[model samples]
Target chain A: MSSILKKFLMALTGLALVGFLIAHLGGNLYLFLGRDHFDGYAKKLEEMGPLLILAEIVLAGLFLTHLFMALKLTGENQTARGAQGYADNSKNQSTPASRWMWITGLFVMMFLVVHIKMFKFGEREKPITAKGEEIIKAFNGEEAAKQFARESGEHGSLYGLVQKEFKRPAVVGFYVVLMLVLGAHLSHGIASAFQSLGVLRPGWLQCLKPWCVALAWLIALGFALLPVCTFFGIGIN
Target chain B: MNFTLNVWRQKNANDQGRFETYQAKNISPEASFLEMLDVVNNELEAEGKEPIAFDHDCREGICGACGMMISGRAHGPRAATTTCQLYMRNFQDGETLTLEPWRAKAFPLVRDLVVDRSAFDRIIQAGGFISVNTGNAADANALPVPKDNAELAMDAAACIGCGACVAACKNASAMLFVSAKVSHLALLPQGDAERVRRTLNMVKTMDEAGFGNCSNTGACEAECPKSISISNIARLNREYARAKLLS
Candidate 1:
């Protein structure tokens, strides 16, 4: 594919992923409503069965394609300079986030692997079905500590799993840092996607860069806060 | 002022070049950087040695012919100043400076400190012109161009195609140059007819010429003689993506 087309595909796939994050965040937010709401949300997602699997497959394709194209394009860009390189590279005018995109992207990609393993598609899912489900149910039943805790019964209790996982300081720290890296990647990527698709205007340039970066920060904050709040027992019974 | 000059010396395009150091003594502080080179070249000529062959025309900044790497930075250390506009006063009396050509795969080395920039001309040839023929000058206010757009077009049109953007880029990307040309025309009504074709063809030419993809490093903008905005690059991407989607 042409470089331009590759970039367009990246933008399309990236924006779609961002849309998925929004929905995922919304569903995750139901955790604050207690165990029944949280597990029910997960059940609804799994209940889609083939449709959910199809969506996951599409999501994986979009994600891998984005990574693949980004790597290829970055490699080509590096080769274009051949052996010639600037002696005073520090003089470049791009932002720090813009400059370190590949590094941050790589980090984010690594985090994504760990993330899917830990939460989405890793060994966490295996024990979830094999034995951990009952343990989670027991934890959810001990909600007598808080008066505001919803009376929830007969669910997988993902709320317990989340609460248990976040209580670990190391896990929460890793998540918070990962969210920041994800923020940096999204900050450049969002406005850049618009420019890649030819939708950005000069008038929008000033507004777009900061707003996009800010939006990335907001999303990061939203994600980052979850572990912090979980550690503080916001939704834990 | 007296200084040591480390000039890139390549006999021909195929010849491997290395820095040939020479002493430039008794140089005027106010002399342009090119003039200091001229003095050194005259001294070389007096001794029957080959004067350093570099590209320059219209010693002022506007012509776009004069360009070289002065101490690793394109044009010169001063931001928004062309090599021709750079003065010896900017350097210290005992300063040692290195001069090299704008290095890119697309820009083939012709000799010392001069690379064939006709690749740029070819890129311009691809779609830099409007096909529309305006018969004659109509009224003073004939074709209406919005004021802000007119100014922005002129801002983009200010690019002299000096290849500083190419020089500054770590990837050797020409997105800024291509975008400047595309945008200058795209923002105008006369440019409307060829907008799609122009962006597509120019980008194709740029890519085929072995230029790198833009990383939006803004190095080009930092070193540009005209200070062309990277936003133009964003516009170029925008235009290129639109063209690809349509045709």
Candidate 2:
């Protein structure tokens, strides 16, 4: 395929991933509304059944395609530069975020693996409340938490798990750092994706960079806020 | 003014290049960057040593022949200025300067501070022209071109094929140069006949030459001596997509 086509695919998949991030951030922000609202939202997603699985499949496809194109293009770009490099190379107008995209992208991918492991497949302990402890004791411990959750029309104790995870200084610190890396990736990726797909014009060019950066940081700040607030007991009871 | 020069020196393509320091003494601050190099070469010749080899033509900066990375910048520290037009007055006395050639897989080093940029000529040969019958020039008002398009075409046409865009690019991508050539012709009525074929063929040729893909860093536009806008790159992408869809 032509280099432009490769970049076009990269841009398409990248933009799709950005859409997923926005939606995911919006849903995750329901945590601030307390345990019932957050767990109910999770339950509603699970209630989609096969449709939720299909959505997950599509999201996975987009992320894999984006990763594939990034690796292929990055390898080609490195080879195209030849073996001998400059003695003292310096950037003229590129930002740090733009120049270090590959590194930031790889870091985000690694962060995603840890994130999914922690949230999706990890243990969800019962909430630390008087009624919650009594229910756990009466239902015969941690395994009954899911049964109780289903009976009560919720998605287990996911809110409690999130609160427990964020209460750890190390976990909160890791989440915040990864969110910043994600922001750096998006700062370049958003504007670059538009340029790659030929969606920008000369008139929009002046405002595009700043707007992209602002939007990227805003999303990062939104995600980062959840962990920080949870760590400080702002949204926890 | 006097300066220290650490210039890349290589006998040939097979030679392992290295930076060699030379002292430029009693240089005039009014001299252009190339003229200062000429003074150093004269001194080397007087001392019965090999002088530095570089490229230059029409030192007025229009010919696109003279270029080198001066202290890590494509054309010294001046914006929209080529090496031949960059005067020594911009630098302080006793400053140390480093010079290197444009390095890319498509641009093989030929000698000291000179690389073969014929890859650009090949890209041009692919489709950088309009096909018309051999006859007298057409009347200026015969074909009406919109004022905005004409100005935009002129902006793209200002590109001098200097290869500075590649030098400035972190990936050594030539998207800016190729886009300028593509845009200058594609924006005109005379180029409408073969626009699809031209965009496809030129892009294919550019890829086959081993140039990297554009990452939209804007460094090319920032360091372009002609100040060629990256808007040309966006236009090139649109043209390429349109051609792909049409065919």
- The alpha-carbon deviation from the true structure for residue A81 of candidate 1, after best TM-score superposition, in angstroms, is 1.8
Would you give the TM-score of chain B in model 1? 0.98
| TM score of chain A per candidate | 0.84, 0.88
* Per-candidate total of colliding backbone pairs: 1, 0
Q: How would the docking of model 1 be graded?
A: acceptable
Q: Give the winner by DockQ.
A: 2
- Once fitted onto the true fold, the runs of candidate 2 whose alpha carbons sit more than 4 angstroms away are A126-155
Candidate topping TM-score: 2
Model 1 stretches with alpha carbons more than 4 Å out: A31-36, A122-156, A229-237, B2-6, B20-26, B43-51, B91-96, B137-139, B241-247
lDDT of 1 at B72: 81
Residue B103 CA displacement from its true place in model 1, Å = 2.3
| lDDT by residue (tens digit), candidate 1, A1-237 | 666777788789888888887787778788778876777788788889999989989989988998898888888887777675544456565678877888898998898887777676422211133234454566684534221233223234456667768889999999999999989888888887877776777768777778887878888888888898888877554
Error of 1 at B187 (Å): 2.8
Compose the digit string of candidate 1's lDDT tens values, residues B32-65: 9999999999999999999999999998899999
Q: Candidates' lDDT values, in order? A: 0.83, 0.89
lDDT of 2: 0.89
Q: List the residue pairs that clash in candidate 1.
A: A198-B238
